[model samples]
Target chain A: MDKRFWVLLGLFLLMTAAGLLLGEARFVFANASLICLSCIGIQ
Target chain B: MAFFARFTDALARLRRAPVQLTSTLLWNSYFLAPWLKNVPCPGFNCYSCPLAITACPIGTLQHFIIIRRVPLYLLGVLGLIGTLFGRTACGWTCPFGFLQDLLYKVPLPKWRVSNRWAPARYVIFALLVVIIPFIALEPWFCKLCPAGALEAGLPMIALQADLRELTGLLFAVKMVILALFLLWMMVTSRPFCRFVCPLGTIYGPFNRLSGMRLHFEESRCQHCDLCRHVCPTGLYPPEEIDTAGCIRCMECLKACPHGALQSCATGTSCTERSHA
Candidate 1:
């Protein structure tokens, strides 16, 4: 696999794990936040 | 031969009388101003745009974010269209992209952005998704959007009281930017898709993984620069075939007389259609 894929995979997995540990609503909100950040510039 | 067949299908759709007129009206009103009333389409057409027949999907998505509602109906609508068309919305349906397309028709000098600029989309994507929702209290994307200037700012300023009193500074700045971009487009073809547009940023990654894709048979390529020359997005097709920057506008396909490139859905290849 590409190096960038591993990096992205790591980040996604880390976020997902954190969300699962944190709970459902927060996880959804966090995922939404990631999506939002991805939508526009992250600054 | 296979390439010509796909181009023919696209051309046929373009010539379809009802589709042609409706798309033309949608494309024209997108920039010209004043829609008949409120309609909802799967892509961003500012609700505030005078001639808008649709509410922006991004705006509505933000609404769901704020209200904490699931946007069941809106998601259903967006999802249904997305499943069928993917980034076809960017090419065919999006008012903002259409505006950029029109601007690109102007005659002028232009430059192609570097791949270093590709990261800028992710930055825009982050800002639109994270900062706007968390910081700004309104439709954050709309506030600074030239699309909004064409869609909402012009008409709302005319029709509404408080909006009328507002100074033209912000709107003027946006217009100047739009004019500059249009000039750039005349020269460059698609500077906005290449360097700007957050929605394009969003839909772009999806295009790579979408059922719809640009397929390349590297063997057919004679190292000729024709496809690269015709590409408005200025993507290096040989080096990076599936970059997220591709808008799938198909100009390269049209420009290629060699039948090298094609728009394909899934595993379907022009060379193997009979087997399928």
Candidate 2:
């Protein structure tokens, strides 16, 4: 697979996991997590 | 007649700006986005957002779809934008597109899907406009919308007031989906624009034949591959542009140093550049 493909896959999984985990704590947790993933990791 | 012509010329120039100042001014001055009640047009604003000054077209449409009524006001807003610039609104005025542009600025591994993926947008369009509202009796598009998350969800939740009480499993679910999409966008070009944006779907078909479209000067052909390469959507200029897939982002305009590409109205001649 291409490098970006791997990076994207990895980021997707990481963000998804983080969202589910933090989402249980506070609804905002999911949004915060996503913004971070999109703004920091994927970006 | 001279005065009217001058006014038209000024309006044309304003519409052509890389960034539309009128949208910005309207947003702020008139509370263009109902969600950003505190700020004018605060960019990326959504109307369903508790504080918005203007209504969201998508939200309004969804509301109408669910209720089985036509939303004249919402349609008017979109029709007005369409009448003037067609999909130019996607490029210049949309807060969501602006937000996506900012996300694109981040240094990350980005991938562009094949043209095959373009059809998925139609599926999203269908679901948002047809299926979801019929089943849910509410605008499901707004629920999953990143615009809502940023414009409404975050602000209302942060404020800890009336809307805070509305937060629940559905809101949480929407937030999760939103994060995944945004993170994916960081890795990919535009997940929402490509796959799940109903607004894009609405404007997509119109863009193909819109008075505003990229006119190719077949004579100016160096065929340098720059236009093709620079196109974020990977559209082949030689073929009919898949307007649904094009956000009119103008990457090709800048990429074509040869001045071969120009945005013009349908059936316009190539002898001179003209805006429709």
Candidate 3:
């Protein structure tokens, strides 16, 4: 792999860790579990 | 010996079918939703599908936009996948893409979607996923998405008859959009992936830098354009092998008679000078 590839991998990994620390996972999970009527094209 | 040979031949003919089918089943396995919905699915699938186990990354991304939060976790997961295999998920995992592949198999005339439309994906993503949702505080793309209509809207309405009460002009519009796209699929190789999928837009650029990449040996190539015929995204492999447009379906690799195109692996720098 090139230096560029490693740089991107680290960047994404850091983002994921930061997001997790910020509790975005819980936010995503909480939102995802709810079936929004708008998503299924319902009014 | 004959049986072993036959088995190998059958598997070869099957190619990506088995993996694609397995992925389609696993992602929409319904019962797995409780544990998996926290994570974003790599391909374009509607998380609202009755059987969907994981959240649609595009849909989740829109929710974040609507809520005025940065989608760091979802983007990280998607970015990691893009870094790993590029748009491989579009080829082998997307249930919606699988449906298109199956529809295209009908004995109908096929036409290639033009490369000119490639930028349309970026436009669509920007408008529906980010701009509109952020402005309206609503998931606009999900409202119009045919995949959502096919997997979630129709099924949910059909199963829960009471939902029909909520199905109004907007629902009819979604159905019409779905019908048009379905017809479009019969004559096109991958119209949605090539020109419309926001998830594909997100992953498309990574094809150039992904660990799993395409390597073309120009020294042996006669430019027969056989790869172009087999490519799901209509990419001419010689010049456009790993561009922002390539899904890394690898059909070009198998179609090259001269063995000029090969899938290069991670940790190995492709010595070929021409490729990006």
> Highest DockQ: which candidate?
3
**Could you tell me which residue pairs clash in candidate 3?**
none
Sorting all predicted structures by DockQ, with the top scorer first, yields 3, 1, 2
TM-score of 2: 0.70
For model 3, the DockQ equals 0.54
Instruction: Report the C-alpha lDDT of model 3 over B108-149, residue by residue, as the tens digit.
Output: 887766888789989999999899999998899999999999
Cα TM-score per model: 0.69, 0.70, 0.92
How far out, in Å, is residue B80 in model 1?
3.8
Give one digit per residue, the lDDT tens place, for model 1 in B145-249: 655565556556666676455545556666665567656666665566666666566566655444445666667667787778766567766665446776555
The stretch of ten residues in a row with the least summed lDDT in candidate 2 chain B is B34-43
CAPRI docking class of candidate 3: medium
- How many clashes show up per model? 26, 16, 0
Candidate 1 accuracy as TM-score = 0.69
Off by over 4 Å in 2: A1-43, B1-45, B161-166, B240-242, B271-276
Lowest summed lDDT over 10 consecutive residues: which window, candidate 1 chain B? B267-276
Residues A1-43, model 2: lDDT tens digits = 2243335335444543553344322322222222221111111
Q: Regarding TM-score, does 1 or 3 come out ahead?
A: 3
Which is the leading candidate under TM-score? 3
Q: What is the overall TM-score of model 3 with all chains considered together? A: 0.92
Cα misplacement distance, residue B46 of candidate 2 (Å): 1.9
